[model samples]
Target: MSQVFEGYERQYCELSAILTKKCNSATILDGEQKKQKLSEIKAGLDDAEALIRKMDLEARSLPPNVKATLLAKLREYKSDLNNLKTEVKRITSGNVNQAARDELLESGMADANMVSADQRQRLMMSTERLNRSSDRIRDSRKTMLETEDLGVSILQDLHQQRQSLLHAHDTLHGVDDNISRSKKILTTMSRRMSRNKWIIGTIIVVLVLAILLVLYFKLAH
Candidate 1:
């Protein structure tokens, strides 16, 4: 019984160590990090399988209590493995590339043994942090895009305003030219009328003077 317990403890330690490494790898989502974690997980899983096999063999040689304990442990490992598979499915559901999927699968299986309550709590915290960071990055990118759109809209408005001002300036210039031309025509007509009036006044004074001279000569005769 003591020997069986020792083996179980060793198996638990090995599985826990591998799982810790896998969770750490998940913290790094880069290609190289994923690949390295995948390799480590595969190796760890192999070791775990070997330990389980040894435990199985020892089960047959142990007392009833030890046998029952080993069987229960086996079931726990199976349950952990199933959960690992499901986690892999979730991680790779976002149209991830083949290499990324492979790496996520490897890291997800690194800890396929029953975990302690403390370890579960830590894992949950880590997952939450990662999700929050991803959301923040997405929001920042969206704000930048909106700012760019606003800048483009303002630029278009300025361009239209500049065109309007230029058109107004051109129209005012044409009106000024027309007014100046009309003023010159009006001045020329006024000067011509003044000269005509002077010529007509001189002709009327000459005719009246001639009529007075003829009447005076006839009366004297």
Candidate 2:
């Protein structure tokens, strides 16, 4: 009896998880992902329904709390399924409306060749509407041309400004290069000056040593 109740509890949990997953997937996924998720949801629902029926057969033996919980979960699952159905219907209906609109337009085009007076009237009205639309388009195109001319002028000004900026950047870079070269030249000159000072001091020391040696030799002689 305990094992039977545990099995029912596990099945209820599985159904609950499936319902939660289905609701989340429907809300978040779209296109092919949505379709795939919906299929999985349906499969889950089928499995849950089967499990519920099996549990129902043993309902008299089940504890009151377990039975109540199962009923509540089933109700919630039914509500979610209804909501999903409504969403699917809404999406499909919108597509149907669009398709109907397209078919109406196509039919109107075909009616232009029909011999009926009513059809001719509709054709005339459609033609007139098209002509008016063409006129408006022509006016819009003229306005667009004027706007384009203004845009071209603005673009030219922007191009000139960009060129000026580029020239300034180049000039600044040249100045930086010149400063760097000057620093290198000054460093080389300072190093040469230090070497020259060292050479001059060595020469002075050698000449002094030679003079002292000559004085000593002359005294000894």
Candidate 3:
């Protein structure tokens, strides 16, 4: 149960981050920015879907009541993501348009719609779905907190695991950095050594020539 909850927690955090990133990315009016955000949202959705499957499996193993609650939460999350997808589709398709473009806009049907009625209805739907999903996720989290045994021992164990993972990651990063620095240093040293060798060879050749010249002069005299 704890393991399943852990996975769900990670998924929830990822989804939240993706939502925040999408919102931030959407702030940029550029098409590139929008595309990037869209891609991120897709990836996030994929991760969420995978997590949902895992949760489903774990839920099957849980007590009937817990399983039912989790299943309900999962369904709500699925619905929410679906809604968001629809809204996003509408946005990409440019379903929203000027009032002059459609009579529905003047009739208030379009006005009631998100952003613009001319904008793809899919996109608007997606937005609504995401909002609902977020809400449900929050509710689910609260329920889990209240129902689950989130004692100090469990929390401390999780903290230790997190710390270990973080430390490992940092250590790997440090090693990579060290290796990069070492390579740079080695390259510099190799270049310097080559220069030094060239200089020494040149000096030796000059000395040899000088000695030969002196011998020749002495022999000639």
TM-score leaderboard ranking: 1, 3, 2
> lDDT of each model, Cα atoms only?
0.63, 0.61, 0.64
39-67 in candidate 1: lDDT tens per residue?
66656666766666676777667766446
Using Cα atoms with residue i matched to residue i, what is each candidate's TM-score against the true structure?
A: 0.45, 0.33, 0.39
Candidate 3 regions exceeding 4 Å error are 1-3, 20-28, 97-221
Q: Which stretches of candidate 1 lie above 4 Å from their native place?
A: 1-124
Please give the TM-score that candidate 2 achieves against the real structure.
0.33
lDDT per residue for candidate 3 within 8-60, as digits (tens), equals: 84565457445544633343334677787777777777777777677678867
Clashes of each: 0, 0, 19
Better of 2 and 3 by lDDT: 3
Clashing pairs in 2: none
Candidate with maximal TM-score? 1
Q: Candidate 2 local accuracy as lDDT?
A: 0.61
Worst 10 residues of 3 by lDDT: 110-119
